[model samples]
Target: MSTDPTRETPHDLEAVDRDDAYAQLVARYSAPERVAVALDKVKAEARRRAKARQLVTRARGGLLHNHTVREIARYFRKAERGRVDLLQVSEGTGIPLTDSRQVLREFVDAGLLYEYAEPVGKEVRRSYALAEGGKGGITEVFIETEAASRLEEQENRARGTLGWGEA
Candidate 1:
């Protein structure tokens, strides 16, 4: 009840002291758990943001269909490091080639698909695989010589003879 104009009122001082004390308590008690909880919240928010971005992209006429995306992702996931070209994926998933290409490009932009290159004849060919965690999205490009291609063709024929499924 001091009358000094410069002096903070008891209620004002109490409120600030209470806030500081609460902050100190939060920092000191269950600190690790609190940190983990905060981190989880941040990650969840980021995921929500990514989903929103996906939606917005679709709304903007970007061809971001959930069914198509899921089909493409599943196709690559099943491939499991094996590369598949666009035409093969399109045919397997029953999605048109144009739509498949757009979807695959979107997945690549979203960090959910990996694009790579392999040689076919004298020219290099582009292919794709599913991105896993943060490691699988990186493209692996290599040149395949004629001998290598011939060897691969022989292996592919051999696999065909054994009745293996294509990715």
Candidate 2:
């Protein structure tokens, strides 16, 4: 039997005090055993969320990083002058397969590199090289800043001073 009107609904008992309930909860969780369990649960949840975030980030990624292309270019510069497989380049550069494929295609189209296949006893293995006739103008493109060089090359190509006009 409670005196508080809120507690004495129709023909009911006392209402629970929020502060008392909270204090009880705090005391229960403050115990070492409870604290350890709670901490472990929190840490586990954090790890799960972190893994989810990484997956979401990779899945949602739209634009390819220029640095990734630069890294792949550097890989090509150091690679042997023979063709290498897509998997080999991806593994060596630690770039994702999809990204490596796209970048390599772009590089080939841009003539920063060339792509071909060589017979591997029974099969042909696709490969790439940095030498576009002699060597790719990686430094020229990336060093001059991608945007500015693109603009410059556009003007130069139009004026018959570079790219297809050069040859």
Candidate 3:
């Protein structure tokens, strides 16, 4: 109980960092099982943060994320007409024209949208319509977090195939 202002006694509250205090308390008093559970919680939080960061990185790299795809679907569902063109989608969704076109083409390639050239007077206009249960298809669409390591992986090639029903 010495009253030295500049001295950091062992009992002083500010002498040790918060993390060191927690470590010392847990090590000395916590049971083994409780310590293991605490560690597991810490690891799960780290993984969750890492995954969120990875998703942000992927979106920044020009890859559309799950929420963006859902937003496009919502626009199509709420639009006056089922059939639309790239420009219409860009304006309706408020996404850039280039990004809208790219995402639509990706869906077309994935068989979610039916694309055709419509004759608008003398000039042809490209149009797209949602396939059967296109909203359902959009819901099923998943963004790849990582690229497949092997070129010969058939699963990677079959991107949007329907899930195999349970045996």
Best by lDDT: 2
Query: Taking the tens digit of each residue's C-alpha lDDT, what string does model 1 give over 92-116?
Result: 8888988898877766666666788
- lDDT of model 3 at position 145: 26
1-167 in candidate 2: lDDT tens per residue? Answer: 66666544544423446556888998887897887998986665455444323322332353445556655756766545577778888998888988898877766655556688889999877787764332324443343334433665788878878653346
Question: What is the number of residue pairs that collide in model 3?
Answer: 0
- What C-alpha lDDT do the candidate models reach, one value each? 0.59, 0.60, 0.59
TM-score of each: 0.41, 0.40, 0.41
TM-score of 1: 0.41
Can you tell me which runs of candidate 2 are displaced by over 4 Å? 1-63, 117-125, 141-167
With a 3 Å backbone cut-off (N, CA, C), the pairs that clash in candidate 3 are none
Off-target runs (Cα >4 Å) in candidate 3 are 1-62, 65-68, 78-80, 119-123, 142-167
